[model samples]
Target: MNIIISNASSDPIYTQIMNQIRQSILSGELQAGDSLPSIRQLAKDLQVSVITTKRAYEELEKEQLIDSVVGKGCFVSGANKDFIREQRMKRLEEKLLEVIQDSKELSMSQQDVIEHLTILFEEDQTS
Candidate 1:
């Protein structure tokens, strides 16, 4: 598992960790049954407080993205199809929101935004 912490981000350290891990799991980069580093070890590696990593792990568990075993460490859980679809849609909405904001900032018309999106979608399909 790979995680990068950004000191400059507005989000809390733990939230950053949790979001990356969650994204990895949802994207299939971290498969079901893959063991996660111990909280202490992850804290050390990330050079962050142990409490931060623990909190991230707890939230992940609550979201059902990871399961904690008594002696064994946390492992990625099998994702439900519906849950995965929901995650994908949420990510799409976030990206679309950003695109809309950028378009507005650029003073682009609605038709311009739609044309750009259509081109991008077709390009993605061809690739």
Candidate 2:
């Protein structure tokens, strides 16, 4: 898996790592039981602190997206499809909440938000 870190991003390093890995899993690019790099190795490769990588792995574990085996490396969890779908829905809801908050702060109407979402969704489908 290719993980990119951006100093320009508002998100922290671990968050970026976690997001990329999560995207990979959700997109079926990373299969269940697929091995991930060791925490220390990934840190070295990414040129970040081992603590950062460990924290990312821990967060992923908490989300049930990956599992670590004693004396072995981490692997993608064999999570059920329903669980994965629920997780994805939760993420989408969180993002929508953020958008709603932003729109409210800008004094945008609900109808405007719905229209923007419809346009964006249709554009994505066409692409």
Candidate 3:
């Protein structure tokens, strides 16, 4: 699996790892039963501490997104599209709520907030 971490991002390193792996699985880039790299290998490759990678993997395991077997590496868990969509929608809604809160706190008009979102959505469609 390929993952890109943004060190300067507001998110923590382990969260970045978790999000990227989850996205890959959601996008079908990583299928169920596909083994992930060893935590030590990934840590070395990503230039992050072993604790960070371990925490990320552990969180995924706790979420039932991946499983680990003794003597074997971690593998993606079998997940249905419905489950993925439901989870993704939940995450998106949470982020939308955060943005809405920010807009409200800033005293931005509803129309202006919607316009900004529209532009962002349009750019995403083009890209």
Winning model by lDDT:
2
> Which pairs clash (backbone N, Cα, C closer than 3 Å) in model 3?
none
User: After superposition, which runs of candidate 3 have C-alpha atoms over 4 Å from their true positions?
Assistant: 121-127
Off by over 4 Å in 1: 87-127
| Model 3, CA-based lDDT | 0.90
Error of 2 at 33 (Å): 0.9
Residue 93 of model 1, lDDT score = 97
Could you give the candidate ranking by TM-score, starting with the highest? Answer: 2, 3, 1
What does each candidate score in C-alpha RMSD? 5.3, 3.2, 2.6
Q: What is the alpha-carbon lDDT of model 1 when measured against the actual structure?
A: 0.91
Deviation (Å) of 110 in candidate 3: 2.2
Candidate 1 residue pairs that clash: none
Clashes of each: 0, 0, 0
In angstroms, the error of model 2 at 60 is 0.7
**Candidate 3 TM-score over all chains jointly:** 0.78
- Best by the TM-score measure: 2
TM-score of each: 0.67, 0.80, 0.78
User: What overall lDDT goes with each candidate model?
Assistant: 0.91, 0.95, 0.90
